[model samples]
Target: MRADADLDLLGVLVTRRGRLMEVATVLRRYGFASIAAQLDSAGGPGHRLVQRVTDRFIDPELASASAGERLRGALTELGTTAIKLGQLLSLRPDIVGPNVASALAELRAGVPADPPGHAEDTVRAELGADVTELFREFDPTPLASGSVAQVHRAVLHDGTPVVVKILHEGVRRRVLDDLQLLSALAVWSEAVSPIAHQLRFAAVAADFDRSMRGAVDLREELANLQRFGAMFAEDPGVRIPVAYPERSSAGVLTMEEMTGHVVDDGESVRAAGWAPDELATRTASIYLTMVFRHGIYHTDPHPGNFLLNPGVITILDFGDVARISSSKREQLEDLIAAVGGGEPRSVTDALLAITDAPPGIREDEVVDDVEAQITDHLTGGVDAIDLAAVTRGVAVVVHRHGLSLPAEIALVLRVVTLLQGLAADIGADIDLRSITRPFALDLARRRLDPKVRLGRAVRTGRAWERLAETLPGELSALLDHIRREGGADLRLRDPDGIADHLVDGLLTAALVLSAGELVSRSVPPKLGSLSVPGLAVAGAAWLRYRSIRARRAGAPSAAARLRLAERVIRSARRPGTS
Candidate 1:
């Protein structure tokens, strides 16, 4: 259901039949006619009409394509928003299968460079000056073009080499429109389709929309670059490009340009005098530190995003990043520790702590699968293990058990996968366990620190104090209700007529209450060898014992009854002469 204002907006779009028809035609061509038909049938606030057109004319080439391929092709054809969504989906192997994720990974935005003067115009508009005013030299030709922005080589007046990233004109408006359409479709699909509901289409769409919108704003990326630079300020091996905020704006970013050997090029890296294995290890260590210590990390780990210049590793592209919460980070630490220690139960518990598993999923099965995967991968030693494969294997098990990884964890897993791929490409043999073990151990030790334990105890004390303050009042209210009603309401399911035992329980409760009252009032001793309270307690215990004995004795023994019946039958046979 939409509000009046939303309805008006939808009406405006409906008036533009050309755009709607274009979207429908594209969907139909991409083997998604069923979805298009659903949208088309849901027209203008009335009852939805049945789609009578059974003949769907799909593209012949797409007829034999796998579902992943068709989806990849459809997203590629749908433009920037769809491309960004595909890229995000590529990181979510738990939501989508590995096959779909792999196929989506191959999806390239391939946005052609805007016309020559477009970049200059954007720069002028964003910085309030022509390129000549801001830089000593500006190249009009773009170095690269992405879905959101394009970069150009330039130099500041101080003669420092830099890159100017400029957002495309009208891209924000276009992306917003597409996002609105997608959201609307998602809502409708979730309402009508079981698969969409299961996949949580609306939630994923909202997250994707937010991510894409964030990516479109150059200011966000600039902030990320600055934060990452600060994080690695003391580390000499890792280099984050310097962001020039004075020369940047919401739609424009200026950063130091990096020129070096791409990390994926093994020959080039070796020629540059860097050992591939050592470089890989260092790279893993840096990322691991970011995740375990800082809790903020770059999500993308493709080789193009890394540059090996001289002795430093320069990271690029801050457009996509993820932040992990402290609790999630702790869970990840536990998971790492458990995996390293080869504790399957602990690993399962840690994973369950971080992810949401479906009801009725067998924890033992998931643990067994994970343990098997770990054993298979680590049997040859940690150095020979593939971190990405291990992570993927865990992801596969999670998916099989109908569990969903949190978005942050999914992105982390994606980064690990990319790093592993990069390592393999460079023929680098690095032990991920060795890199993570120290951090895990340190975290475990920190958890057991006296200060941490004291803090936890203080928090627990406060929680208990609160409960204590409320418990007395709650108990008083319950007693008041029982008194007013003359008895407590109780429900019981008793077979074998054992509910008769409740009479003895009632007597015991009465005796206990009486004894408590007598003890509180300091009643005089009345029994021969005990005080009044002690005698009452003794009588209650004796009554309980007698009740138990009576119940057991009253129940007949099958063998004794059978023998008595046989004796009666034998006596009757002896008198058969009569």
Candidate 2:
């Protein structure tokens, strides 16, 4: 039962359970030998006694484990923390490489039960009451044993059916220790490698710490379940588990046990008489709404969390939820708009700006490449393209640009990709983007409202005012004096001569003074046609004043300034620009 005991000893005891040797073999299959050797190498300096203890457990072939095998072994050896990391790596195939990440993703952290008596003792200790006094009926057998907790089915006094999630004994201490080690390693990696710039290893480790903390606490999980339930309360097709708040505790959570055929398999769905295409559409819609509209989404969308009813897609497990801010939501809207508009550069910029990606990437090239990929997806279709493909394509481009996908984008990508997998499972030929295009448009129009435009214009005017107020005016008076003296004679002088210098100073002063006056005399008029044309005329008058002064001095005609004035007039005519 000791965590640090020799694997061989555990193997011997597990042999009685028929898979002890197999489990030991799996654990030993990854870097166990090399790890032992590393320990041995360290032992020579100050820990000969410790080396002997570790040497006893070393297997010959473990040191030479393949990267995939080593990763799998780490999952087996470390338990919950490693399993969570492996699961995270599964969503980031581009960074981790497909083979190793796929192999690690297959690692499950299902554990053996503590003795029934021990489980009973732990549960009673947690609740400060005996099992019989606490519940009408308590199952001696565990319903499930995950890395962090084990579940037991029970009934409350009022006959409410619930599943009790009990935190494993000493799980907190163990998880904390492993997380600290991982955090240290993440920091060290960042200090020594270029990959750190792109991988953002430290941030990933910190997020993992937060995720593990949430996982170990039944209270947080309970709250998450409640939030999700409330979010889907009005939507019949999307079902979330209901928390039994009366019985929930920090270490133990009681919730309504969800039940349905496995949506992961097509056979179960077909048997349930649920149309696959409809189920896929419904699932996609629920997530799209959560991410694009509500800005909250489930981080994990693997098959284990999904169940299919006749017309419903039930979601379970609430340990990992991603919440995006309003700004991030807007950026996502911008990304969708850019893709729809076939502007790759905008999508790339928005991606870098919104997501906390690793730095040192060429923003321009990344944008162009992402644009090309998006264009291909948009154009390659019969009548419409799939959203799944679009999402995957975007993920791929961002990954290739050495940009790390923050948890928010990762979750968004995960949901869309999972939906794609579901579609394939249900025989749906739906294009994800096609179904979500209208949703994307609605988001855009809401964000790009007339009010938003007016706010932006007001902000720009304030900035222009600051620039104008910073200019000097004494020089303009001197230039005016010169103009009165001899307008044509001033232009005849060489440009580098004293007259030219004075003219340059005069023009600068005049422009600054004019801009300052325009900003200072701002009127509180309603944003209407009259106000816009008035601004245009003021702009024209300023330009005309400069032109007339220049012409009188026999200076070059103010052609460039005139052209700029015309452009401003055109812009002012636009409803939003004004």
Candidate 3:
């Protein structure tokens, strides 16, 4: 009953009517009256009364701006949460289209620091102690201010230099309110707008919710710092900020002050004792190692986030990190390898395999698109590489095919694009293919090692063993239930084909496992980086697996995409609303 009521409350835009009026006003001012109309209608009768009063105040000239210009202006004027959304959208050309994404990319986060004494009071409240008790000297002035938080420099009682981050007063409640509006709007759009449905705005709204909540909490940032500290503990070239967990709380973060220059002004960085080219190289190396070697990395790699010292580099901001699984990493390797190899067919195949391409997508069109991209940006030697162009090309190509890269994958591309831009800004020459190809090769060879193959085979075998052990019991339970129901008519869909596929899968698995077993024992017949007999067995298994995939290719399963029930949801329930 409570769950049903929660759903009931969530479905009504009138619950958040005041905020909706605010949002609708901004939407209309920026030539997005159509979107405002949707929100107004979603709010039932009350909004129309409010809408007329608000509409008289809006000027018509704002609608004369270009779509991208209007959107950028609207999001900027909407303040913190909206600007953050625009930044997020900047990474997704597939959703907002290239023009808007480009404009959104220019959106900057700059807010006036909160009133003085906020950091002290927040620290006192969160830490359960006065600021003087924790730190000998706390600067009232902020080092910098962002949409969500502002940084204040301080000195610990023990005289350790540090920076204190304080969440803006009422920022959490404000972000939640904004996200609620966005999520409700997304839900409404999915139901009424075909374009929004295809773009999965509801899912995007959910992402914004997660991101905003995470950003609002300082603990998540503290934990990320610790993780990165451990990750780069041994590296002399890079430094992760040391966070003070004992003094930190969800609303306040205190970490070791990293004293260096943000790489924006090339002269200052050179003055700090590192040349621009060297700094860029080190930054690129650090990011590449984090992505290729660790499979997890910081998402924001702009010049602002990197701090340069004489011989050391400090990375700032930990709230937004993206992790790719090992399988995803391998898929990325395949895609990168295809790009580096200049094989359009291979690139198309890898992209299609990794991305969520819709059913009935024309493969040849995808290939042609990819081929054009490679020919334009990658055909020239390493010096001619334009990762930014290549990145946009991939986004355009995928969007054209009605496909979307997984959010994490799109972020990875965003990172690559940023790094390339970083390199260019600092006048550094970077050949991405050269930097990444060696790592991909090493990873591939490592995967083929006997120890790796044997470990995987063992895990697979154990999984099968568990399934085999439980199958009979599960079957008995099902049969018993059917018997209690007075027997059942079991219908099968092409049972012979199913059985054939199952048998082929098992046989191929066995052959691969056998090959791993032989290789583990140091089989005499050897090929370069592999055992000859094991290689042959694995080869046969690979062929069989390929054949099975080919046979099943035409009859692809079409997973349900439409979410009518989900879209039917109304506006979010506000804080004081029933």
Indicate the TM-score of model 2. 0.69
Top TM-score model = 1
What does candidate 3 score on TM?
Answer: 0.74
lDDT for each of the candidates?
Answer: 0.72, 0.65, 0.73
> Which candidate, 1 or 2, would have the higher TM-score against the true structure?
1
- Indicate whether candidate 2 or candidate 3 has the larger TM-score: 3
Candidate 1, lDDT over the whole model = 0.72
Ranking of all predicted structures according to lDDT, beginning with the best and ending with the worst: 3, 1, 2
Q: Give the distance in Å from residue 208's predicted Cα in candidate 2 to where it truly belongs.
A: 1.8
**Pairs with backbone N, CA or C atoms under 3 Å apart (clashes), candidate 1:** none
Tens digit of lDDT per residue, candidate 3, span 248-290? Answer: 9999999999878778756777877988767766677788788
> Model 3: how far is 472 from its true place, Å?
17
Residues 1-578, candidate 1: write the lDDT tens digits: 33543564476467545656776777667666443343232233332232224225667777787656777888888788888988988887676767678888888877888887998888888889999999999999889998888899999999999999988878888887777777776776667654455556777888888888888888999999999999999989888999999889988999999878876567877976788887788888888888888889988887888888677998999998889897777777777667766677877888888877666778889889888765467566566666877887777776666677777777888888888888888988676667867876778688999998899899987785565344434443543453365332221233353433444444444444444433333454443566655755776677657656755776422223223323322322232211
Q: Which pairs in model 2 have colliding backbones?
A: 34-63, 386-431, 386-432, 386-433, 387-431, 387-432, 387-433
Worst 10 residues of 1 by lDDT: 569-578
lDDT of 1 at 85: 89
lDDT of 2 by residue, 148-177 (tens): 888899888888777888888788877776
Q: Give the lowest summed-lDDT range of ten residues in model 3.
A: 564-573
